[model samples]
Target chain A: MSKNGFTRRQFVKAGLLTSAGAAVGAGVLKPTGLWAAPAKIKGPVKVGYQAIMSGTLAGYGEFHKMGATMAMEEINKAGGIAGVPLEVEFRDSTLKKPQAIKNARYFVDSWGADFLAGVDSSGQALALAPVMAQLGKPLMVTHAATEKLTEIEVFKKGIKEIFRICTPTYQDGNAAAFVAQGLPAKKWATISPKYEYGYTCWKMFKGTLGKLKPGTEFVAESWAPFGTTDFRPHINTIMDAKPDGLYSVEWAGELITMIKQAKQAGLFKQIKHIMLPVGAAMDVLEGLGSEMPDGVWISGRYFFMFPNDQRNIDWVARFRKRWNHYPAYVSETGYSAMFAYKQAVEAAGSKEAKAVIGALEGMKMGSPAGERVFRKEDHQAMYEVPWGLTASNPKYPFKVMGKQVVIPPVEFFNRPPFEGPGTHPPFKG
Target chain B: MSTKATYAIYLGIIAGLAALGLLGDRFMVYMGMRVMLLAIFALGYNLLLGRTGLLSFGHGALYACGSYSMALVNLHLTQDPLLGILAGVAMAALFSLIVGFFCVRNTEIYFAMLTLAFGMMIFSLIWNLREITGGDDGLVGISRGSVFGLPIVKDGQFYFLVLFFFGLTLWLVHRIRSSAFGLVLAGIRENHQRTSFAGIPVKRYRLAAFVVSGMFAGLAGSLGAMLQYNTDPFSAHWSHSAEPVLVSLIGGLQTFSGPLAGSVVFVVLREIIERYTQNWMLWFGIILLAIIMGLRGGVMGGLEKRLRQRAATRKGGE
Candidate 1:
């Protein structure tokens, strides 16, 4: 026994005393109200942005952050939203769902964020959705493309706080089907990661293809685990099927790995056409470089070259200047989402969650991608989704999308057979 | 008399904490639930590491197995929350039985590596099995069920439910620690050969401890799954498995309450540090290093030892 030593009893007593002191201190201390102090209005309306700040998906997170920062800067320079400046409180999700939820809670509960925004992974977005619903906070999901999010099973069944700005997986699947239908491809084989996003993409593409061209034989379907580095076996299986075309839904590192492996194995040359649902990212394209097999069609959430609008051009230029690279669909989607949030806030004329949600529903907001609106019936964003043919470009460092077409949102998004009961207060016309 | 008083005091503190958690805002309530859950997990880990001297690097698999079971049961089977939890526990127990059969064979590092291998295998299995487990997208849109037939809709109600489970787990662990089975485990930990010579089945005792630990961990995991409203493959990852080990080590592996204290401190610190800076790992590493080097017996263990010493010195002076 030492002089500084205290027994468990003493320590417990001390802990209780400390807790009592804390309680008293809390009572005596001047309470800070939930809302930010009006007099402390700074340079901007600080929007705490938390996303995957680092990891394998670091590049995408950085791009999304850059996009949000650019949007904030642009909005502030353009007299700001509702005459108040906009700033961003950037937190890192580290590409983990738990961390994403924690950061979301912190942003809303502690930082007093005006709006919650940005998500890269569908799982992360889904995890944060319930919290957003509970908090009655508007979250503009920018990157995650899982259609189940806005479906009746999820959002309509009381989780109505999520507003997906990115094109849903179903939309991308339809775009692929639309492209595939026009091509001289009869049999289709699919290799997608086994997840909601990948599975949904596969199902929707197959279903859409079936609807478009009857008697299209589905030769083979290989479901690789997400983040599986080895695609050799799967590629071999796909090649063995010898389908006229291939549909690949693998994205990020897995996609990069598959593309390189497929190119080496000469699988790309054998298939008449390859439709990668998520290979349109600038990072992935750049990573693939010349190895990104030519003539393959791909659909993405955004393509810097697809939109010929001045807004799109300006956004690309600004983003390029800041990030030192072409903006991916994710970055563009994030940028568009923030702008959309501002539009909704302005339209609602209040920061109230329900009011803003009402303002967002069916309200068209202009972005570089064009006027995108959230279908009031379901919260799915309705807009032009970009699909393009892949081609090697010496002018740029990476592969670029060539001969692109923007699929109208209405053409693909199935309106009826909503997944869940609508909990969002009925649209007041 | 001292033990009884200590028990009473701990109960009082726990009750007070629960009340505070109920009264606190949503953020506090959420954090409180997290702490309770983590504490329950750490307590389970402590049974093996602290009392039984068995270090498991694969408990996360059991935890995740329980969570996924809960998710599966909740999604596909009956949404009866209690039934879902029971299903989770049952699955975890079954998983532990299989893994523990192979794991309890070796000693020290071999045991650890075997557990790690098993845990990693489970992680890979969960990550790859998309149809059943949802793979990377995870099992989403899970309904948070009721507790003991009571609606756990509100944060306060959920907090109490978590506290109830947490308290139940704590009491169970305490009872086990003080029981004759616990003494046998301690004997096996202290000297396996001597225990065997004394006609005790060292292997059986060790396996029993592992099974009990797994069951409690499963309960915690199931609760966590319900709390998060989803279960991802990460729950089964080696990193998650390592968390309990870290919690136990940091809290000091000497006492029953060490892991509980460690979990509380670790989670709270993580939350506070994350709020201030994004580079939390650097700070965390530094703090953990300081604690390990400075405290020796871990934060709580060192504190308790010191307190006992001071009380002894005062008694001697008197």
Candidate 2:
């Protein structure tokens, strides 16, 4: 050792030899010895986003990508996770199962992504769940609302990697049931896209209504395949039933198409109240425009006007500033999911998967949607589900929620002893 | 060269693919299995398009029929994978027979369009009948069970099973292409009226080819269903039907192994392009346009043609 830590000859001799050989004698080696730690590997985190990126439901995928990109940019700005920059590896599921499965494998293998995210369709999500389990990688689902995802088949079958940001279909249905109870409607007509999510929504809504209002009856039900451009037959059938109110689970372009057809067919004027469970999206509302009608009850995962908290306001402002449009509940759900992941990671203090999973389960975190907690029992998020009457607003380009009600987590959630298996209603009608 | 050389080449390719699959990780094995399955399906489609000159756009319906048959069999019947696949093939053949009887009457675009409409009808029917078909949720929880007597759980094992079937299908198609019946079909393709005048029942041959194609497609579909452990209405979509057509065209429709070569290229290209860009379709469209214009006879066809030209020139010089 010399004045500059080593003499000129000593430094030259050390430099002449490989680092590993010097370490053998001196017991001194840098932690990441000679590797240079790979200068911030350029390339997005390769998030294998699978959604209906084409066809009718393309907007949902676009919104999801927007929300994901916004969160990714923020995360990168704060010096990315352990200095590995994030990137998105998107695959258009085209709302098909085979394509979804194919994309899942491609994302995991070809794209070299350890983590996976993004699925809009419940069908697609259910298809991907087992594959994710098989691969032993975490898939952060944002938009799919299937109740069965966190149930026995997936969560109990050694698939602890799946985490959902959206409320389960049952929760959305229960919220609709809660809204239905406040209205003067007793008889109900329901129409949902004929699939798992649709069937589950109907089942939960019926079950919740029966428990809350014993006298309430389901007068009629109509199920249509998704992307059914001609809702005329279904609409006619619903109108002919003449129930006191209608419960609808249709959303995105399908919902917009139904509304336009129904409005033109004079179906909205006849029904006392329209309980559109997913009608709160700005896309749907904007498409419907003034024809959305007043006093129709609507519930969603997020309402831009509901929370009024600093987090919610700031999120909206930032989202508006970036996209030049109001963030829908879908976008907010994605934003909340990213924040939830960040919180879980920070809480765990390590990116170790098991630690982060433990942190996530039953963990409470503040989102722009308000205080939400993931139930340890089933991994379902419990939070303030916003419901309101849809009214035309001049201040905004589309229909906005008015006369809002925020159903507290406790009021809506069936707290543990949460049924460890099977399904349970989240709210009383 | 000789029949032995042809068989050797086919076996060599299969063995090489198996070795490659075993060396790779689970993801590669999975992709390899997918490519082989698509190759098998495209080969089935090729039987009609390549040999019979009958373009059936509703091959996806037959594929879905096979998949749904397997799903139903897997759920209701014994989980014996062999029996399930056989059941799928049988059901698909039966469906093709019914659909082909009416469809074979038309030719060209009319036949294609009719098949498309029928395929979409089946798609909608299955999608709408949620109680049985599981609706859009699809039939999940399908166990892939043993192949023959061996437990086929690993991706590598499944890959060999796919390769085995793919080789068998290729052999069968090769035999069919060289048969006297193949000659008659070729004659029909060149001139249906002339073939009809020659006392051959053109409609019957076309329908037979369609059914055979459907059976093979069903087999591929069953393998896919087993691999994915689920099936959906998308398998029956018009897009799925068009995949084989695209593969056939891209590989050179005239060659026996064109679809197989095309399937590998198509799947690999898609995987590579999708990794870099989300707008894979835009890139795929551009590449496909280039392939179509630059190499009219497709990859193998162009290569074979060039080799023949080079050999002829060398012989003349000698």
Candidate 3:
């Protein structure tokens, strides 16, 4: 390898020669196409990142990238992952699945990425998660919330290269459902963006809530298409149903639009209660602000203020000081993915994908979000999910999640290895 | 030179370029395949807009239909990439035929709206149908299988496969544009009322053009889906459809090579701008605005206009 950087030609040539050499020594050849030993690298631990860095979804992608950037900077400053400096190459996924997949290949086949990370769209993640087996590189999914990554049939067939550092859809739904069960109102309705994430969110919430409260009725449900700017009709339909409570799962900018419209109409006031678990996130909080109605239940995977542990406080302080904004949950997840990677790389004492996977399989690490343990069964990181009622506080300028409650991991979340990755949360609901 | 010689020269140029792409850097091979496939897509789109004088806002859905059919067939039906590609083409043509029947009756904006409506219907179907279409996740785990006996597992090999089709499509486009059928289509585009007075079936000719455009776009979409081994619902979106229209317009509408030029410019510009900053859409928007304003009839149209003026000036001097 050259001192500067290795060209794709050289890599291909070297690979061909090695394979040819192995063929000459037929007795020594291995079953797997590649040689058993991993290549020794002398340069930075390069990460190929894909996210929506442009267009409407830029903020989410930017925060995710920022988290990753801070993680890389911190790691390098402290002496990098396993004494090798870290490098990250960013590509705009344009919030599209095909683009994300293409970027994944380009990063490996073209950018010579050591490991791949980052995606903001659950749609991107759903398409990308299954194809990880072919990439043969560890992809740390930091932002996308699709449980389908681990729960889907193809993924259940044993995909190893894929891992998520963020909360999955079901877990978020489970916590939301668990919280909703305590409410006085038994009747509920759902208004969410139509997609896998929304489906999974409502399904899991309804499933868990149904099991808990057998009489609870889902009085109304409406699904607005993703990136929908107008939510008037959907809101009107939900109001007409007149359920005592509402379950919402909109994301980013669209969520803000939905809230503003819902508020304009007397929908929030008419409904006894409302639940927008993701809508209470920093982005929505910052955008909607005083417009965000009071006395409603909401949650974010990370609230930046909660946990308030020394480690988290310092991380947030540093992040805010640098980025000039409070760290979004996506930032925390992206940051943690890198740190988990650093831990795994150092623990394994190599950058080999297999070695890193082995080290990270069941590893427990404290993250800014909270304590996280990558469940060996499904390779999903189990962490505390922070949920709270949407309330304004004097200390913070934005909508503060009051009555803060951290939802512990569901029992079924961490399955025994013998039973397999566990059955996907039943679709009986 | 004879027609056969001209055809041979075009094939030769394409083959040479394909060989160069195979030996070029990874991005060149990757982006080159994308450009070629998109160029193919734009060719069909330009036929409707420039040759048939029919504006379609629905080819993105047609393109998506192509890629999705290819992906689904590969994933569930067969391992043969050829079969998947054929399935893609057939599906796209069928979609266009159904949509075109209604779309071709009206002219201009009505036709545009009809096509757009049909296109969004496909988009909604793809978006809402989570089980078979994989919803927004799209169809994944598609493989580019061996062709007859030759393998096409590598990017270089895939580039050659696409190149062969690119040449074939070029020849087909040339033939269609030059034939009596082509003359009738052009006549309809220029003055439909006059063509009707001449006793030509204008609607039938328009439908044929629409089908032809759909087939070519479908072919490109299938190859593109195979190129990535992935296809998403976005492929079937209005935005995807807009891509071909943009390429044809920017490269110069009404020019045979305009779509190809536009596709090359569009892909290369995005690739180049994306390298420096994530805000490629901003720069791209600005560049496209400038090109549309400065070049007017598109880059190729402007060039042709200049050439015509130069010929006129020379003749005046003589």
For every candidate, the chain B TM-score is 0.97, 0.97, 0.94
Which portions of model 2 miss their true places by more than 4 Å?
A1-47, A82-88, A155-158, A392-394, A409-423, A426-429, B1-5
Best by lDDT: 3
* Candidate 3 lDDT, B171-261, residue by residue in tens: 7998899899999999998899999999999999999999999999899989978887677788777888889889988999888878988
lDDT for position A11 in model 1: 95
What is the total number of backbone clashes in candidate 2?
A: 5
lDDT of 3: 0.83
The residue-by-residue lDDT of candidate 1 on A1-429, one tens digit each, is 788899889999999977776676678864244422343323345466777776677777778877888888788889887667776888888767878887887788777887888887788887888778777788888887777677753445756677888888865687788788888999999888876677788888887788778999899989887568999999999999999999988888889999889988889779978888788877788788887878888777878886788888887888888778788777787777778878877787766678888898888888988778787766778888678888766678777877887666666666544533332111122
**RMSD after CA superposition, every candidate:** 12.4, 5.8, 8.7
C-alpha lDDT of residue B123 in model 2: 90
lDDT of 3 by residue, A1-429 (tens): 668888998889998987787776567655343654453545789999887777777788888888999998999999887667999888988887667876887788777887998888777776776556766888988877777675552236577888888877755687787778789888899899788778878988887788767899998889998779999999999999889998998878988999899989989889978888787567899998788888888777677877879989999899989899899888888888889988998888889899999999989998888789988767888887777877789988888877877656744252433233343332232
Structure candidate 3, residue pairs in collision: B60-B241
What interface RMSD does every candidate have? Answer: 1.6, 1.6, 2.7
iRMS, candidate 3, in Å: value is: 2.7
Each candidate's fnat:
0.51, 0.71, 0.71
Off by over 4 Å in 3: A1-41, A130-132, A153-157, A410-429, B1-5, B300-318
List the candidates' TM-scores in order: 0.88, 0.89, 0.88
